[model samples]
Target: MARGRKLDIEFCGFGDGWEADNKEKPESGPKETLPPPQHCLVMQREKRRGKPVTLAGEFFLSKEEEKALLGRVKKMLGCGGTLKEGWLEVQGDKAVALRHTLEAEGFRFKK
Candidate 1:
């Protein structure tokens, strides 16, 4: 009870043989399905700093799916790209190439 002094204490009457038995793990929610081919994805080309970049949108994909798709597209195109506000931004005017690539993956595009 003194200033900065530790008190000797003992806890009892709680049964010494008690053990925790939480073994079951909680399950995660179901994964989301990507949009079907009938849903058209929108693609647009824009010029930034005198260079062209393609923006692919309207896929209605989750964040993980978008990141994975961006990775695959970047690898396939051998160029740098990023995900911005749920849209895929590839570095170049790759509208035609992106259209073919996404079409191969069963995705439709706006005419």
Candidate 2:
């Protein structure tokens, strides 16, 4: 019943044994089928300093797919962009060009 610095503690528990399988593990997760790019949306915007930017949205895609697509588009256009809120926001007035690229990639350009 002494209220000194609370430094003493005791606990007991059981954990799963440390034995781990050494065999190569197969990948997990069912293959995710993303909707065709034609199901996506495209738009344009003016950001800070009146910078023109293009955005492609409405993608029924996983985060990995989105990142991969975004990187491919950015590299294809030789520009920069960030993936936000499941959308790809690219810098510059490249909406038209982006739309063409998307179309070539089997994406519909609906803006």
Candidate 3:
């Protein structure tokens, strides 16, 4: 039981010594676990205007990650590229070169 102002009510156990005995036990729950690391990378080629354009097929990454990867690919191939709808679109065809780079980076391409 408690009496006095709201603040006093909250601090009722103060200085009484009996307050220490009235403390409530904290509740506990299961701990969260992180997901496993991703493996394997997808590769696909798209043709536009009667020409083949090689692009990074699957792009599951944040904006910063996407930007970094796009830059790396463009620099390695000496070409221009864009990140669109979670896909990396590089100008011209560089599928073989891109595949080699991805494989060297510990990612296996699917066909």
TM-score of each: 0.65, 0.62, 0.58
Best by TM-score: 1
Which residue runs of candidate 3 sit more than 4 Å off their true CA positions? 1-39
Minimum summed lDDT over a 10-residue window in model 3 is located at 28-37
Model 3, 1-111: lDDT tens digits are 467635547745667656555678764444232211344456678888887777775655666666877788789889887887666787788888887766665555555
Which window of 10 residues has the lowest lDDT sum in candidate 1? 25-34
Q: Candidate 1 — which residues are off by over 4 angstroms?
A: 1-33
Instruction: Sort the candidates on TM-score, descending order.
Output: 1, 2, 3
- Assess each prediction's global lDDT (C-alpha) against the native: 0.79, 0.73, 0.67
- RMSD of every candidate to native, in Å, equals 9.6, 8.1, 14.6
Residue-level lDDT of model 1, residues 15-65, one tens digit each, is 677656787866456535567475578998999899999988766677777
Total colliding residue pairs, candidate 1: 0
Spell out the clash pairs found in candidate 2.
37-107, 38-107, 38-108
> Which has the higher TM-score value, candidate number 1 or candidate number 2?
1
